[model samples]
Target: MSMDVRDLGGRPVIIGAGIAGLMTALQLAPEPVLLLSRSPLGADASSMWAQGGLAASLGDDDDPALHLSDTLAAGDGLCDAQAARRIVYAAPAAIEYLARFGVRFDRTPAGALRLGLEAAHTRRRIVHARGDGSGREVMRALIAAVGSTPTIAVIEGFEARRLAMEDGRIAGVLASGPTGPAFLATARVVLATGGIGGLFHDSTNPLGSCGQGLALAAHAGAVLADLEFIQFHPTALDGPGRPMPLISEAVRGEGAVIVDETGRRFLDGVRGAELAPRDIVARAVWKHLADGHRVFLNVRERPGPEFARQFPTIASACKKAGIDPVRDLMPIRPAQHYHMGGVAVDGSGRTSVTGLWACGEVASTGLHGANRLASNSLTEAVVCARWVAESIAGTPAHRTKPAIASDRPSPDPTTVRPLLSRALGVLRDGEALKAAARALLPPAERKDAASDPAAVGLMIAIAALRRRESRGAHYRTDFPHHAAVARRSEITLEAALAAARELAPVLEGVT
Candidate 1:
């Protein structure tokens, strides 16, 4: 496929239209930027579906140190202390930054910010907008801000398929749009392309979020960290939906309970009960479901009649499922939500690859180490967007030769979903991970539509297989205890493919 080369004249190109991408473009403003979105703004983004809001130390009783403590605890001993502290400390300011962008967060009648709560949080630090429609409100403001900014050029309906690299550095971005493939030549590229939830069968993220950013970075030889840690929300509205509707943890914070179909409070004896860190709760819910018992979020007696008023988005979803949150027992199940892994980056969001930076769910910034604290993901995105923009602004845009490319179609995660759901779900074992790695090898080696998603799955399988002990979101059933010494795992595409190749013969012979 012949490509049209569009020289951006050293203008920075930001990929993905989620909060991170929009905010990064806004931050770089007065200076020109090219923002590429696969879909229109507010669509196909996990950030647009975020209901829990941004976690900030804005409560009178709260402090950034306290927020950092909760974050470190949730991370299960693998969080980078420095990075976590920096982001958490900047969170309150980040909230203000959003407000400046015209995000009208929920405020009290007396004109004070009304904070909410979520699981694993020690304080009421969740700064939300429109109650449960936080993401919608936030995106609305950012989209408006991007539109009005004279320097940021928004290009919708463009999917970034590959990073044009030369001599181990970024040359340009090859993207597919309505007309066809176009290569935007520039030295700087920022990947804010969201999570890998679409690679799983049951997820709360948009189905389009199949880790495209990770695939691009990996193929460009960037290192990825903690690929095994995928957080499953304990209460996705249990029913049929392409991407399951999330029953926000804020509902549980508002006094909801998890019980069996028989109305027995199954998590009664668990520490922190229904409000424990996500990994623990997801495991318990997954186990209960595996035991042939139906689980439901018993909000009938707790949030009661006030449920709809506080969580309109979730309420509407429940209503669509033919259940009224004020009266009915809402069926619930664990679904893949946040991923605590991606292109490994430093404090400035600069990846190992030169001229390449990553922010949001696509970058493993060492903030959410093993598992993410509820609502912290948004805070990280907002705070890191500024840092990423600054880093890009300071770096010189080197000119490169016109990039050559074989245009490829957007990735479809269908083939890898079941494989991941079975081998890398809430419960996993070495044998299953090995089998999955072996199965994904050939597809990952190919250059077809399945290759990108398959490569991502293969990497995750290899990472999970290597991490023998249970830790946070990644649990190996065969090795159900945490190791004495905690460590973060990293893998490159080549290393992951090599690991899979080594395991294929051994697993094939055993099978």
Candidate 2:
């Protein structure tokens, strides 16, 4: 018996209810939006875990041009100038938009918004709420607003597995919920499915964020770019834990320092030391760890007593781990934090495939380039969400069609994680990447939603192998030198699969 696909009644359907998906749905109010969340909205989302706040030129000492310059510099030559400019210039307004939704930003004594500085920023322009609870506060406001909006119908605990296409255009999405599998028939499908952090063993992302969006888009023939550029954060709390706790960059901005076991600052030689670009800082921390030295983020000297008051979240997390930030040195290490690469989209968050749009971490909008500026992600999510909403609003919906459902078993994420972490983690070499490709590609044959992580993993490994140079977050130790020209890598799933098959001969006789 064929299960009838649930018709969304020509509504705009959004997958992954993070900051982007929620924001997009809210922006498209009165349009009857269908929003899907893998978990409850605000829970299991990177946006809700974001410690650092949104970056904006709201400070009197700052301006958009300065923000743009810092963004381009941090992007390491791949940032789209126009996109960066658009997001940066829209920062103040985006903040205002959030404020209107009842987001209570931390304010000064005079009732002015208090701004903080982060690494790579020229000015103190980061607008935070509840010190380190920016993501939580922002998400709280967005979730409340969403609940109040009658037009936005949220389906929690339902994960969108694959995008259904008809006649080379997006027809709807095939999703699996707690009940079983069902198809959602809608013309406009927006993917706000976050990043590929879950593919790594050590990541600051929820386990559910396993690059499903990337896989879904790629399977539907969307263009993916810069798959090699995974941003490993330098200060994930080093301990036995999955989805490691993050020590916000704002802690460093407040004058904390990274120190070795002997209290030696390893990043002293770097131009900005603790305040350098994340890639540089992460590499420095990684090398220190590889050298058998214990690395810790020392905040005792600076924000000692103020820690509990300013960053209640980090303070609470540290307390739970039996480490007091006011007295003990907090151990930290590099962990997979963000992906600078994802489903390629334009400024308006439109993917290569028609009727499919993307925003947030899932969509590579050429804003982050080779690396992302701290706190700029939230800004990009909001800006791009609004853009995607406006784009979808003006565009007419297409006729819904029945989607073909497949029951191919998903590749076990447990099996895929080790291969991806080994090959595509903080450091990479061609051999490990090739081996990972060999191991990951075979399982990618199961083209269902569950196999998207392996497929996305294969894409990253292959892309890393192809880009034989160190750039930004993608540091290939074998290719220690930067290429003469900086270029972005764009590939389709078909092309990556073809490349993987050609290397099959090398896989024989290897475990």
| TM-scores for the candidates | 0.97, 0.96
User: Could you tally the backbone clashes for each prediction?
Assistant: 0, 0
C-alpha lDDT of residue 88 in model 1: 99
Runs of candidate 1 with Cα error greater than 4 angstroms are 1-5, 506-511
Best candidate per TM-score, number?
Answer: 1
lDDT of 1 by residue, 1-511 (tens): 1222375678889999899999999899888889998888888889989999999999889999999999999999999989999999999999888888899999999999999889999899998899999999999999888888888887888899999888888999988888888888888999999999999989999988999999999999999999999999999999988699999999999899999989998899999999999999999999999999999998887888888888899999988999988788989899999999989999999999999999999999999989999999999999999999999999987677776555797898788889999998999999999999998999999988999999999999999999989999999889999999999999999999999988867545575
Task: Name every residue pair that clashes in candidate 1.
Answer: none
| lDDT against true structure, model 1 | 0.91
Cα displacement (Å) at residue 290, model 2 = 0.7
lDDT winner: 1
**lDDT value for model 2:** 0.89
